[model samples]
Target: MMKNNQPEVWLRGALPDIPKLLQPAAHALLQSKEEVFKYTEDFPEALLWEKPAGRASVGFHLQHITGVLDRMLTYAEEKPLSKKQFEYLRNEGVENPEVKMDDLTHAFSEKVDEALKIFKNTPEAILTEQRGVGRKQLPSSVIGLYFHAAEHSQRHIGQMLVTISVLKP
Candidate 1:
C-alpha cells in the first residue's frame, strides 16, 4: 500500500486509451510503480545490494522488474530478444559498486510508462494475437504476455518489500 493510504490505481479509474481487457494489467503495473517509489524513497544506497538470508537484493528486483517487462513487451510485439537483452538477463543479480538506488527506481518507473504507451496503442483486436516467449518460443497471446508482465512485476515487488523490511533495521 502507498504511504499516503491512497486507493490502488485500479480504483482511480480507467487509464486513457488502454483497452478494457488490458485495464487490469495497466492498473497492476501502475500500482507496482507507485509502491516501488514509495517503499524505496530515502532508502540507503548501501543496502540496495544486500541479500539477507540469500534472498534477492532490492537492486536485483528493481532491475529485474524493468528488464522482464521490457522483454515481455517485446515478445508481445512478436519480436525476439536482442543480444543486449540476453546480456542484461545474465547480469541481473550481480553486484555493482557503481549502481545507485535512484537509477534503478527511475528505470522501473520509465518502463511502466512505456508499458502504458504500448497498451494505449495496442488495438483490442490484436490482443489475442499469438506470440512466442524466449528461445523455446513458448506459446502465449499478446494479452497473455502483458498480463504476465504485470503480474510478474507485482510478484517481485512483494519479494523486494520483504527484503527491504528485513534489512531496514
Candidate 2:
C-alpha cells in the first residue's frame, strides 16, 4: 500500500520501485495513442487527421514525445545522439504526410523496450555514473533516466489527448 506520508517517489533522487512503476504508465501511454490513431470504423490516415489549427499538430507533438524519450535513453547509455539527429526526429514527422503513425509509435516503443531491457540488466552502481546531458551540469542516475523515460511518455500521452479533443472540437 502506498503511504500518504511517503515522499513522492518521483521527486526524490531515488529509483522508483520499477516492478510497480514501469508497466502501468507505459501501458497507458501506448493505449492513449488510440486518441490520435483512434479505434473506430472510420479513423482516417494520421497525416489527414488535423488537430486544431493553432496548436502543435498531432504528428509534430507525437514526434517530439518520441524524440525526447529516444534522446534521453541514448544519453543514459552514454551514446547521446547528435543535435541534428534530435532535431530531425523532433521535426520530421509532422512535416511529412508520408510518415506512418503506426511506424512512429512502434519505433518509439521499440526504443523504450531496449531501454527497459537495459534497466533490467544494468547494475545500479553503473547507472549511477554521472554523465552530462547536453550543456547542463545537472547529473542523472540510471534510475533517474528510467524515471524520466516513463514520465516523459505519460506527459506526451496527455498532450496527445488534448490534441485529440481539439481535433474533435
Candidate 3:
C-alpha cells in the first residue's frame, strides 16, 4: 500500500506532468513494482527456479518482468530488438544457481525505474504513432506498447506471487 493507504494506483490521481492517458500505465507499473518487492523480500533462492504444478518458475517471472519491459519499450521507440535482447529472450527461464533472489528483484525494480523515465519523457502527441512489434512486424501504437508493458509486468508479478506463496514455508 502507498503511504496514503490507497490500494489502487488510479486512486492516487494524476501525476505531476504525466499525460492523462499514460497515468494509468504509470500507476500500474508502480503498483507492480511495489508488489514485486513485497512478495519477494524474503523469498528463498533455492526455490527461485522451482515450478510447482508445471507453472513458470519464480526466476523466469523475475527475468521476464525486466526483459519484456525492455523489449516492449524498445519497440515503442520504433526500434528493432538488439542481438543481446534476443539472447536474453532465448535464456529467459534457464536456472542460474548463483543468481540471488535479491539480484533478480533488484533488476526488475531497476527496469521499472527505467520504464518510468521513458514513460515520463513520452509526449502525448506521439501516443497514436504506429510501431512494429517482433520479426513479423505486427502493428501497434505507442500507447498500446506502453500499456502492455505495465499490464504484462503485473501479470507476471501475480504469477510470481502465487509461486512464492506455494514455495515459501
Best by lDDT: 1
36-151 in candidate 2: lDDT tens per residue? 34421132455334656666665666677667776777777777578787677656545676676676666666666666565556665675577657546368865566667666
TM-score of each prediction: 0.97, 0.67, 0.93
Candidate 3, residues 1-169, lDDT tens digits: the string is 2243565776877777678888988898888888887787767778989999999999999899899999989999888899999999998989989887888888888988888888878999999999999999899999999999999998998988888889998
Off-target runs (Cα >4 Å) in candidate 2 are 1-42, 46-53, 90-93
lDDT of 1 at 117: 96
Model 1 lDDT on a 0 to 1 scale? 0.93
Residues 39-111 of candidate 1: C-alpha lDDT, one tens digit per residue: 9877788999999999899999999999999999999988899999999899898889888898889999999
Report the error of model 1 at residue 37, Å.
0.5
* Most TM-score-accurate candidate: 1
Superposed Cα RMSD, model 2: 7.6
lDDT of 2 at 163: 66
Q: Give residue 64's lDDT in candidate 1 (0 to 100).
A: 97
Model-by-model lDDT, in order? 0.93, 0.57, 0.87
- What is the Å distance of residue 19 in model 2 from its true position? 7.1
lDDT for model 3, on a 0 to 1 scale? 0.87
